[model samples]
Target: MCLLLNLFHLDLETLEQSNVDGPYEPMEADATNREHETEQGGTRFSDFIPLDFEEEEAVEEAIRRSLEEETVQVPQESRSIKTLTTEEITGIVKAHSEMVVTEGFRSIIVSRRNVWTSAIRQFRRPRFVESTDMLYVTFASDKNSTEDAEDLGGPRREFFRLLVKAIFQESGAFEESPNGFIPRLSVSHVQNRVYRTIGQMMSTIIVQGGECPALLSSVVLDYLLTGRMFDIRVSPEDVADLELRDSLKTIDQATTDDDLQRAIESCESWRYQIEGLPNPVTMDNKDAFVKNAIIFHVLLQRKSCYDQLAEGLECYELLPLLKENLPLRVLLEMPKVRSDLTADVVATLLKPSYSVLGSNKRPKEELMVVKFRDFLNSVQEREVEECLHGRTLTEAEKTFLRTLNPGHILAFVTGSSRVPAVGFQPSPKLSFVHNENKYLPVAHTCSNELEIFVNSKNLADNDEFEYNFLVALMNGANFSAV
Candidate 1:
């Protein structure tokens, strides 16, 4: 497939000289002959894999079955029960009533701006985890339209990307560490049950769409699953307090007794914080003191905050899913949270759809698809010179291609700048714009489809096509802000 794709390359020199840039005037006889050929089914682009109705239905059913299979069944004996106070019970009941109102709807609707609140609200609904309904995302542009068409996959992908970014901000419940993000104690947030809201949102994104919150500390995750800190390794960098962190770092680096003594003396200034340090510590027990300090600061001090996060995570029964799916569980705590999105990786995920072989639109559609492939290969290979492989690109075209990072292309189509932990469910489809008058590309994120204008007479007419595509991407792919 790649070999065939390589056959079609754009020559900017040739494109510049072509008369196709002038207004297209199709001869009546040619149009009639092309239509007759299409009616007779002369030829078809069989290589392009279109997501037909049957394939789409199969995808839905497979997702439904997996949703049912993944829900954790907690044993009644092991489940913890807390006696809620009158105020707590009343709040719980009231929240449940509000969530119940959305039960009849098959999908939750979220917009780019309101992703956090919408996710928190919809995720709290009892059936969000258990129900097999897919997630749908609505765009700000869709307000005036009257149609049932919404999320196919693009909007949902965009929604998760948006939601995840908002959840992991520095001021939020989690803090960055060398290991990954660890939960931080926020008194007001905990009092408001914000941890639980985040927990529910995480589980829903994973269960509903396979988007994992890959930014979490392994140690924190292990504790969440097992309810015990096992093999805890807290480095100086992990300490949130700068003074304490420097003290521990100094103690760890001390080579001489005098150096060790000085570091220990500095720690003595905050002797009250050293939970189990021996008074007047010597070199013999300095290691123990350092270890204790690490434990006290990293685990003991923040245990309450971590505990609340665990409460929310377990509330939606995400523990079992993580426990059972070892690879996915491992992904959550991985230090490198995102996959390195490359051009080839993005190209492989695209499945182009074509009209019938003999149709009048087929030739133009096929060329557009090839041009798109050329764009991917050019980006992937990073051809910095004016010429790509053997073909030449004008300076403007080269600059445009250089500006398009693979992630931007992926997000423009899939709605997330980073590939989802589970990968795009139904690979993004490439289709042609039905209206030749429209030169720009349009992305239907819900369906994971990118529709490109294909009226360009041949490879020569691509300068305008490329320009229009860039305009569409810059205007429509407003993803960088998040």
Candidate 2:
């Protein structure tokens, strides 16, 4: 399958020149042909796998062992192990391939963008005439476009090149594809990350009490940009299908009143009667129904809980808007938080990231792992949590600490790698350093860009939410000058 994909495929240079940019008005003949293909039971691009292969448990075990063989440093403090993301797996796979990973190739692997799906559609055109999701789709210019040919755009073609590189990184998969390897596993991996991201964001709101417009905009923008909402999407064609409807019923991620109604209707017949039983769907009532639907979706049977939420939404209007908004649209265009920033923060915290078994650390070199969240709140301009636990600093380090500017906001992140600390039996106390970066000493902060140094994964818990509230209040009060 990989050989065929590589062999029949046009070179990247050829795709660049094959101009396909035009309006949406496809030829009547092409449309007729597509309709005929659907009538004749042609496989849709979404459903097509390169081969009828399922990955074996043995393959999974081998991959796991390969990862285990690579050394990992155990933290001084015990922690629930973090799960490896697909992006990290990509790196491991690349390393195993004994490939010299160039920066350009690495970018293609780490990209959350739909690299593979869009490319394969064009590669397998004619039979796979159906389109993959792309932002600025280039149509063949109407003048030149004929029943014989259609042009896919430059960006679309470039992605296929990236996809080819990604497959090469997982070179074993190319061979495994014939037996039972999922060629589109990369797409699925990214899609899962997107879903997890959404879950984390939603968790932030519900658990962390960040119901403010700012957090909402952040979540909406991430959701829009990632484009994985399509995973839960119920296309118009599938709207009436039981499988699609059941999925809607299960997920209950409706964005509008229409979607909400569809969700309730999708349930067994008895559920439909209850939807309009309270009030007919209307402009005035959609919001009300939506709130109920959310409650129903979550609680299912707990009527008292639904009443509890209804009482609150009526008073404060805290109903979560699952639909797109202007805030979301405006923020989507802004740049994302660079992964390197997080990487720097992580690097500074972990002394020896990976080590061989039974390795020893110098007495002074053992790191003090402070919860980053605490450090941010404690500092005026900056902080040295090391001092609190009796890790005395030299005169030079102290002088550097004093130089921290109070005006600059000291950046601290959540999570830390486990590290050894001295025996200090004392009550916890808060401390801070000057805010200015001028005082920062020593190198390395963000080490692992892909994996955050998370001490706790439950971002929505009560403590996390309350922490956000206090921080917001402090910031708000600080700005309210006379």
Candidate 3:
């Protein structure tokens, strides 16, 4: 055994040294020198010709010709199948290659065409998408599909998921994360999760193809082919909901006049970015989106845009809010929320006191009820330091306060668990002249609210009286000083 091991070691060393010293070297592929290498598992420029990569103009011409040609009927087991020829595959690939897509998409297809083609074979034959002007394909709809039951094919589905993600990565529209890449499908930075799943279906379908498929083609086809959102589904209740929503949309669109159009354009356009999950509103989620949009835009007085949006969503039920008269929906039974201050903002505002100048001797001022603006001004510094505890006012809070104008009732939440639902105040409701005893509770009302002057100058001047004079008349003033 020792002699054999020594002989093998000596032979290995001699082979290594002799190979280096002798006239033994592997030839490298030198495309520039016109000397091609017979290398395995590496692309040579020669391979592109077989893969059907061609000049854009030439490829486009071939595709145009093939598209004009009709397929011959081939019989197979009592069913006619259209088998794609080499020319057809070439035309399909070249046409798709030349189709408009995001920049990085083309290079990925060129590098992984064979793997993609194999993936495509898992589904039915590719179909030309006239809408997007590209080839498209989809999962083979199971003729043997079980109704409303899980298809126990776990590994197959997992493979499809991976294939779809790989395709989406080629588009360069996704953001890299620890888990994987997440698609950024909208400028809104948020989308419906179902729409995202639909997008994934589109991506998966895209890469599983004849030769090469455009990402946009699959995306457009996903919307065109299989959204059950507006469609009447198997579920009767869902069918009714979809039908109702569609009817509402149709009616709303028909009623949209030039004024309404302008209102839509004029409404300060804003999109709500829901936390954690971002998705485009699909037919399945249109109503919910509109409801949320209504609440956000209406309260913020971004009426025209959101109102029109809600209308477009076919939410006829929400149209009344567009008139900017959302009824007194803020329930009185709900608990009144308290102010964050040492004193209650609403209660303090309700107290009766006259605005007065300093007395002759004391030279001071006193009042129970101050103007909301004056109160805010008085407390701003302290509130900014202490009101938010350790944290400062967020952009959302600042924006809310800006839109929550002074005349609007600032309701306080009284129930510890109940959230405050504020009603819009188009015009003030004075309890009496100068609004001496009316205040709405507010949750976390700001200390630097804008001024909304309610008192008439003439009335205010008439109401003003010297405290000393009133005290003297009431037998409380030191009359001897006068």
- Please give the ranking of all candidate structures by TM-score, highest first, separated by commas: 1, 2, 3
Q: What tens-digit string does per-residue lDDT give for candidate 1 at 318-383?
A: 556555433335324543323334565455556668898899888877777777766666555654
lDDT of 2 by residue, 221-295 (tens): 332323232222222222222353344444345667676666556444433534332355544554445444432
Clashes of each: 7, 29, 22
Clashes of 3: 22
What lDDT does model 3 reach?
0.25
TM-score between model 2 and native: 0.18
Across 130-236, the per-residue lDDT of candidate 3 in tens digits comes to 12232221223235322231222211222333344343432222322221222322212111111222232343322222111122211111112222212211111
lDDT of 2: 0.26
RMSD of each: 21.1, 23.4, 33.6
* CA deviation > 4 Å runs, candidate 2: 1-482
Could you tell me every candidate's TM-score relative to the true structure? 0.65, 0.18, 0.15
- lDDT for predicted candidate 1 compared with the true structure: 0.54
What pairs collide in candidate 1?
43-357, 43-358, 44-357, 152-446, 153-446, 154-445, 155-445
Candidate number with the higher lDDT (1 or 3): 1
At residue 454, candidate 2 shows an lDDT of 22
TM-score of 3: 0.15
Which candidate has the top score in lDDT? 1
